[model samples]
Target: MLLDRHRSLLFVVDVQQRLLPAMGGGEGCVARIGLLLEGARILDVPVMASEQYPKGLGPTVPPLRERLGNAPVFEKITFSCARDETIRTAVLGTGRRQLVLCGIEAHVCVLQTALDFAAEGLDVSVVADAVDSRRASSRELALARLRQAGVRVVDSEMVLFEWLERAGTDEFRAVSKLVR
Candidate 1:
């Protein structure tokens, strides 16, 4: 299904500072998510972020935090962000049907959160290039399970272009520069 920008909101999962150095391709994942954030801003798609146990995991990394601005940031101990009251309320409050996901530890928090969102009847899509785990095998397994469970796995560019819908516009030119 084509993701409608009006129906979409970006959910940045626990891309924390302490966890990233051990995660495979974590830096690359951050870069990809940053691009998505910029595109989301240009498209006017609302964004919400979650930080898992910030005291232990640290904050949502410097780069992403800067982009977040005044966007709501939830702090939770739950593996499934959907279970966190603040996050659940914020997500439901948006009224956006399509939830585009990006963050760290694809096998754990990201995986559980996607499943919970799907079960809640929201259309869920995880940005494949913007998520990762400490081990590649774990990441692969999580993604395999995610597909089996009905969540759409997509890349950041696919989402950005879908949101843009066409080229030659001012917004397109701005968003296209992100990928380049």
Candidate 2:
């Protein structure tokens, strides 16, 4: 299914300072997420973020935190954001059932969160290139698990274009530049 900007919420999970540097290709993952964030902003998609034990992991990385602006950032100790009452409430509060997710530690927080949300009957898509683990094997395994369990494993471009839906407009123009 195509991603509808109005019906979607971009959920960034644990792309924290200390956590990011530990992931393989961490910088590249963050760059891909940056594209998602820019596209989401241009398309007016609602955004929400989560920090897994921020006291330990540190807050969302500076680049992403700046882009988050006034968007809600939930702090949770649960591996699955869906398992955290406050985060779950805030996510449901947006009234958006489709979640576009990007973050670190794919086999842990990202994997668990996608599984939980998918089980709850929400449409969930995890941006593969925008999520990472300390090891490539773990990331791949998590992605395989996610797909087997019915969550869509997508790339950043797929999301941006899906959200854009068409060409020749201002939103498309703005988002397209991000891709380039």
Candidate 3:
């Protein structure tokens, strides 16, 4: 399944400073997620970013934070973004069932949150290129686990195009610039 503007939300989990270096391909994850955020903005999709233990990991990377603006951003100690009552409440408030998920430590926070969201019956799709762990094996393992749990694995472009749906709208033109 793909993201539908009306039914989905972009969930950017902990892409923190102290944490990113520990995440496999961390730089690439941030870059891909930044692109997703840019596309989401052009498409008018709501976005939520979370920083796990910011006191240590630091804030969401500067570039990403700059792109996010004042969108709903949450800081939590919980590994599962879903476990943070505020984040969960905020998500529930959006009433968006299709979740476009991406972030760091794929085997832990990202995995746990995706599973929890799925357990709540929400359709969770993890951006394959936007998630990572310190170890390549761990990232691969998390992807395997997420897939096993029925979370649809995809990439940032898949998300943009899926939300675009058709090619002629102004939204499509704006998003196409990303691929260009």
Top candidate by lDDT: 1
Model 1 has a clash total of: 0
Clashes of each: 0, 0, 1
Clashing pairs in 3: 24-133
Residue 37 of candidate 2: its Cα lDDT? 86
Our model 3 lands, by Cα RMSD against the true structure, at 0.9
Sort by TM-score, top down from the best: 1, 2, 3
Give the higher-lDDT candidate: 2 or 3.
2
> C-alpha displacement of 5 in model 1, angstroms?
0.8
Off by over 4 Å in 2: none
Q: Give the alpha-carbon lDDT of every model.
A: 0.93, 0.92, 0.90
Each prediction's TM-score versus the true structure: 0.98, 0.98, 0.97
Candidate 3 Cα misplacement greater than 4 A, ranges? none
| lDDT per residue (tens digit) for residues 1-180 in model 1 | 988899999999999999899998988999999999999999999999999999998999999999988889899999999999889988988899999999978999999999999999999999999999999999999999999999999999999999999989999999988899
Model 3, C-alpha of 177: deviation from truth (Å): 1.1
lDDT of model 2 at residue 157? 98
Tens-digit lDDT string for candidate 3 (76-146): 99999888899998997898999989998889999999999899899999999999898999999999998
Off by over 4 Å in 1: none
lDDT at 140, model 2: 98
